[model samples]
Target: MPPLFKHPNFVHFWIGQIASSFAFQMLSVGIGWQMYDLTNSPMALGLVGLCQFLPQLLLTLVVGHVADRYNRRLICVCTRFTMAMTVGILAYGNITDSISANMIYLCAALLGTARAFEMPANQAILPNLIPNELLSRAVSAIASAREISVIAGPALGGLIYLIGPTTLYLSSMSCFLVSCVIMFFLHYNFTVKTKSPISMEHLFGGLRFIRGNKVILGSVSLDMFAVLLGGATALLPIVAKDILHTEAWGLGLLRCSPAVGALLMSIYLARRPLTHSVGKIMFAAVAVFGVATILFGLSENLILSMIALVLLGSSDMISVVIRSTLVQLETPDDMRGRVSAANSVFIGSSNQLGEFESGVTAAWFGVVPAIIVGGVGTIAVVGLWMYLFPNLLKRDTLEQ
Candidate 1:
């Protein structure tokens, strides 16, 4: 096997993720476009985020427990299969021209439930698939592949949208089906056939562990809050259409541009690896992310906005690499699923809640104002977190 593809499971797993990532990207673009077009209301866009995130927010504890006690591989396969089915139904509706805002919302809810389960299982399964020595590289490799998918998927989705919305939905369903099939080939299986009785103590264990470890707490919480405040993805549709005066093609390109920067950065991280001032680097990256977002909000020109987005993505990639490595390395395998579950909840809240916030704020204030305010809030979060997690800031390296 090549250095990047050392473990057979990792290879198969990474391939599945790339396919699914592309599908997910397309789903996002298609739905975002459709929602805005159907209602032409900013709040409707906000509801899209709310519907998708509600399941994860409501079921985090239960989902994590299930991941820990069940076969992680099988869980991933099942959840993704469920997702495929949900997307297939959406495709059918699109093909029939019977898709309503209400129908789309329902599909989003089902997909979110499937995703809520898949995320923790997928994260927990990674360390088990490859050697510890190769974990960082594996992580980077996975991130890079996912970024590639995001880059291509949006562009493809846009082109497909031009052909017909039905084509785009069907294409996403095909990708999801392919991902589910490929994921089933992993050879090693880990499962706890019989789980202990469920209890409040067990449910909150992941939270306790994280709170006790300042390093992990700082890293995870920082990301959760920073991205929550800084993220402008929820408004990108608005920017691509009303602000930049671009159509579906431009929207697709705008979506893909950030991933291009992220893809390039992930490749660099895979090769060189971050060896020093890991915590400081993460903080710096987040601050840069905030600054870039502010610039993006201010830019009216398409080229400048794209440049800002590239910077935004590259900065975010650095934070992602650092945070994921820290969380995985610091956690024990037995507890990884629960911890990852907790992490997923935080992420879900940030991304989804942020979307809702942007929509409401955009509705109340204006798109540009809401975005600029988010950027400033993100910068403030970095400063406050740096102070709170001084140990994380003083920490020297990624090596444990």
Candidate 2:
């Protein structure tokens, strides 16, 4: 048997992640589609991102502290339950025709609250479930599974949305419920030692630790800046409706194309794997992502747009694998939750803030110009980061 799938715990975790990811993807697609249908404005989609990420940014430090001081499994279970309840409420609203933009914003805020705690716990627990030798492969497998969910979920949601938005919401709720059950059965021997009292001092400690780690800081900064600048997902509705002249199904394909490319690349990575030159790979892949985004913005043809999205997805996946492996390998076990929380801040900021940037830019300078400029800015940021962080650029292997 392959070392990557050797542990039952890892297998269970993988299954649970797959289920949750699929449901999450459905919720994402449904929300965007419904919001656009209601408001017909790019800013409304951006607002959705804002509502979801603001809580994560504000609460990440506290959540990280709690994760480190408590049983991670307990944290995961509680967060999942919270998320399920939020989805259930959204589902009820949708089914009864009471769904409104305001209701979605409220639900999104609740979901964000759950995510602030859930992300760190999820990132930290994976290492505890497997041996170090298998860690990189495990991360790759999980990324691949997520990519698969991205590929399948949006397409499915798009088709299901044609039937009704409630269908997708209900499906997402079920996935979360099932995930909670699966999480309950997982067995692990994890225990937090010497629970520290919550204080400003402990929170400061996490910030100081992250500040001192140059490689970790640089890698995360690179990812954050690039995504913040080049991400065009929030304006995908504009591209789908105005540029590509398509409907909900087309919107779903546009969203799913990147994941399709990402899943394919992830599969290749899992098979051969890249044990070195990861930094260089990440840099080049992000550059490719920028170029793809530019092409996507420029193209009016649906086929061309899909191609661009696919390349963007492929490049983004490469960066994700490299950064995640680096973070997991370098972080100390005790500090994993805190560091992962910091990671969530960077990631959440990039995604949510990027949406805001895209929406405002699109509203001001036209959608195509906004997307093109964002891509150009992304490429420039990568070049600048490479020049500034020479050591980071040369980091070819995961820290031992």
Candidate 3:
């Protein structure tokens, strides 16, 4: 068996992840493209992200407890099943030409709720699927899987969009079916160490743990702030249409560029995991991410912009692998759900809230200035975080 595929459970789990993530990425491409196409308003695009993120902010602890106390494979099955139904409705609406913007917002909210519950269990389940020794490589393997989805999803979504919105939605619904089937076959007995009463602390323990652990606190917060400011994915539709002078096809290639870089980097990291000065490397990677974002914002030329995105994806993947390793390895098996839930909030804000910010900012200032300023803010956040979380910055090695 290969290093990442050493365990059968891990193999099944990864297969499920592939389908789930593929559906998600394709859904994202469809939503962003469709919303922008409908309203021609950047704010509408931002609202899509906001509706998706708000559910996690409200139900973080509740979902965390569910992950801890429940059968996670079952949770994965149930959520994706709902997602399939929801997207199926979208497909029907598109075919009927009756899917209103309000309906899209409502659908996005449902999808977000499902994702909020799904992420904690999904993240927490990984430790049970593989041994501690293989964790670093496993994390890389996971990134590779996600990057593959990111690479293929947009490219495919954009191509399929040429056929019609119904085609795109139907494709996503099918991917969700595959995810559900794989989850059913995944066999892993999750051992929950928590035998305590359901108290407020038990519910919120993950947040407390992260609060005290400067490393987790610093790393998660850093990601939250950096990407919260630096992410340009939300503005890409605008860039592709208004600035790059490209249509849906060009948008697909642009979206794929970063993941292309990430997929290549993940293959390298899987074979030769980072072993020393891990903290320093992570910070440097974020800085690189910030610079790449800036370069992308300024470039009007398609080739230069694509190269910048590749750098952005590569650097961000390094940061992701390091943070995931640090957070997961440091937590006890039982607290993984809560901690991962807390981590998911950070991720949701980085991605979803960041999208909102991009739209709002673009509405206030032009898209070009909004993107450039956000990239600068990302760089600033890194410096500030480096100062605040010195332990994370000075820390070395992925193996605790």
Candidate 4:
């Protein structure tokens, strides 16, 4: 067995992460495809991302505090259970022929709330499970596992969707429920007894820490801007239906192409983790991501598009690993939850908010133009960030 997997707590946590991540990916495919199908409007699809992000924006102040002071594992379990129920509600609505776009929006908001709590707690839990020596590998393992789900979830969701939306929802619900059960068995040795009362200062401590740390700030903000500008995943449904003239299964393949690249890169990193020139590597990866996005935007052929997506995903995995490991290693354990929550804000902005941006741009400029412009913008951000944050640009190693 791999030395990392020998840690039982980490093993259980890893399993739960896979289950929940798989569920979320399937849910995303279902929601994106369904919303686009119903409204045939780019704006409605954008609103789905908006709904999910609003909760994260609202909860950022409180989520990290809760994760630090409370039981992170319990928080994970509760969030998974909440997601199970929320998806079940979605399934019920579908079965009853009462599922509206608005209903999906509401469910999305609820799921986002659950995710807001789950992410920080889940991230904070990692350092507690394994030794410091294993931290990078742990992060790599989890990212790789997530890529596996990313690879499978959409494809499976697309296939099962042929069976029906209701069936897909039910399948996602089952995965969340299973995650809840798996997390219940995860045990780690830690006790939280709020040392300080909640105050405005305490709530924003993570942000303060990030602000003082230029490396963390630069790394995270770079990712935020690059992804915010470059994110094309949100427009796959449009590309599949209108541009590519493909069906649900084709959309699934389109969605998973990046993950296929990410999965292969993640596995390689797991075996030979980045030990030097980490910062430059990360910036280069983001640059590649930008280029790949542009390639994807310009390509009309499905195979060419998939190839572009694969390169995009591979580049993204490098950034994800370097950024994640740097954040976790830099923050003290007591501060990890809040710091992770703050990190989540950046991540959420890049992903969910990026979707909104993509939708708005697509609506105004047309889908193809929106993607191309975003790709160019991403490349611009990389060049600008390199000039702006030289400390980040000069960073040579992941080790602090």
Candidate 5:
């Protein structure tokens, strides 16, 4: 057995992550497709991203502090349960033919709130599951799990969407419930001993830590800006409907294309991890991601678009594995939660907020132009970041 699978806690964590991630991906497809169907406006889709991201933006500090102070496992379990219920609401509403665009916005907000807590806690707990030597591979393994969901969830959701939105919502809700139960049984030693009463310093500790650590800050920010600019996934529905002239199933395949590339890259990295020039490799991967995004934006053929997405995911997996391992290995365990929380903000900003950006830009400049511009912006950020964070560019390995 692989070292990661041998650890029972890690296995449970892995399975739980898969379930939750799968549910979320399906929820995304369901909500996004439904939102677009109801309003037929690109701006409404943008609002979906905005509503989901606002909670995370507001709760970053409190979330970090809570993760650091409270029991992380409990936090994770409760968050999953909350998400299950949130989706359950959607399922009920859809089944009764009472759902609306506003309801989706509200659910997006609730789902975002749950994820704001869940993401950082999950990131913090991984180090506790295995020795430091295996951290890189573990990160890759987790990414592979997520990629599998990304590949499967959307395709399945797209197929299931043909049945009914209610069915998709119920399926997603059940997945979230399963994840909650699995995480409830997950065991971990919470040795964090922060007794300092609520103070500004404690709340902002994660941000401060990242600011002080140039490599960590640079790596996280690089991803934030690059993806923030190059987030083409947000416009997949528009692309599939108008450009590719396809339906829900085609959208599902379009959504999963990147994951297919990401899954393959992640599996390879897990088996044979990066050994040297890790910093250079990550930058190169981001550059490739930018180029792929441009290709995707320009492609009208479904096959060509899928190929571009595959490249995007493959390159992105390299960057994710490198950045995740770097941040976790560099931070002290006691501070992991807080630091991971701050890191999650960067991730949330890049993904959720980036979707909003893409939507707004697509509305303003047209979908293809917005995507192409974002891709160009991503490449520009990479060049600028290399100049700004020379330490990250020069860093030799993931090991502290």
Candidate 6:
């Protein structure tokens, strides 16, 4: 058997994530479409991001603590079930023609709550599934799967939305249910070790640890600032409707363009694998991402926009793989959950909070201006991060 498929747990987890990711992409596009259909406001779309992420921020510490204290697989199963139920409720509302913006908001909030627990569990469990030697490849493969989902899911969602929002919700619910079943087969003997009693002291220990680890902190900080400044995903609806003059199907294609680029690149990386010079490569890729974002912001033509988004996706994937590999390699087993939680907070904030920033900026400055400014800001952030973390830039491998 190929090394990638050697571990049943890895196979199951990858397949399950692909299925769930595809559904998630659909749900994401569907939600944006539904929100725009209801309110036609950029700020309203941003509000969706806010509703989803607020719970993640609120529950990050608690979830991290609990993940370390319980069976990771069980936590995953319960959270998947919760998400399934949430999707079902959303489906019911859509089918009954009773779907309101407020109802969607409530559903989003509940999903966020579930995710608060799910994210940390998912990150902390991966190292246990694959050997350390294969960690980089595993992360790359996972990135590829996500990229594939990004490519396929939104397009599917856009097509389904043409049929009706109910179809999208129903499909998403089915995906979630499948994920739950797949998770049931994840056999791992991860037991929480007994430690000192829970207290504020222990909680602060994780923070202190992260603070001391400059490599992890630097990589994560670079990602956070870059995504925060350059993320234009929240403004995609506006671009699809007003700037590009595209229909639902076109919107779907536009959404998937970046993922398609990322997917292709991920396949290449998985085959060749970069074991050294990851730091320099990551910085360059992020810089390219900024450039792509800038071009995307300037382009009104559909083809040009698609090309730009693809470039953006490809570049972003490189950074993601490198950063994730660093985190996995540097973190010890006992501290994995807490560190993963911090990573989640950084990533979740960069994405969701970035969405909020995009919406608010778009509301004030118009869509084009918002995206352009974001791209430029991202480039500036890259420069600043590189300057601040000279030691990180010089480091060649996580083995250090």
Models 1 onward score TM values of 0.88, 0.88, 0.87, 0.88, 0.88, 0.88
Instruction: Compute the lDDT of residue 38 as modeled in candidate 1.
Output: 89
Tens-place lDDT digits, model 3, residues 73-190: 8988999998999999899889889988998999999998998899998988888888887888888998999989877777788888889889899999999999999898888785
lDDT of 1 by residue, 309-355 (tens): 88988888998888888888888877787899899888877886787
List the RMSD of every prediction in angstroms. Answer: 3.0, 2.9, 3.0, 3.0, 3.0, 3.0
Model 3 lDDT-worst window of ten: 188-197
Reference-based lDDT, each prediction: 0.85, 0.85, 0.89, 0.89, 0.89, 0.85
- For model 4 the TM-score comes to 0.88
lDDT of 2 by residue, 47-152 (tens): 8988988888899788888778778877887888888888888779877888889998999999989988989988998989988767777888998999888777
Local lDDT at 158 for model 1 = 76
**Model 2 weakest lDDT span, ten residues long:** 201-210
Worst 10 residues of 5 by lDDT: 188-197
lDDT of model 3 at position 239: 95
Count of clashes in candidate 3:
0
Model 4 steric clash pairs:
none
- Candidate 3 off by > 4 Å: 29-46, 91-103, 158-168, 192-194, 237-251, 298-300, 356-373
Comparing 2 with 3 on lDDT, the higher-scoring candidate is 3
List residue ranges in candidate 2 displaced over 4 A: 29-48, 91-105, 158-170, 240-250, 298-300, 363-366
Off by over 4 Å in 6: 29-46, 92-102, 158-168, 235-252, 298-302, 356-373
In order of listing, the candidates' clash counts read 0, 0, 0, 0, 0, 0
Misplaced by over 4 Å in model 1 are 31-45, 94-101, 161-167, 191-194, 233-254, 297-301, 356-373
Measured with C-alpha atoms, the lDDT of residue 294 in candidate 4 is 90
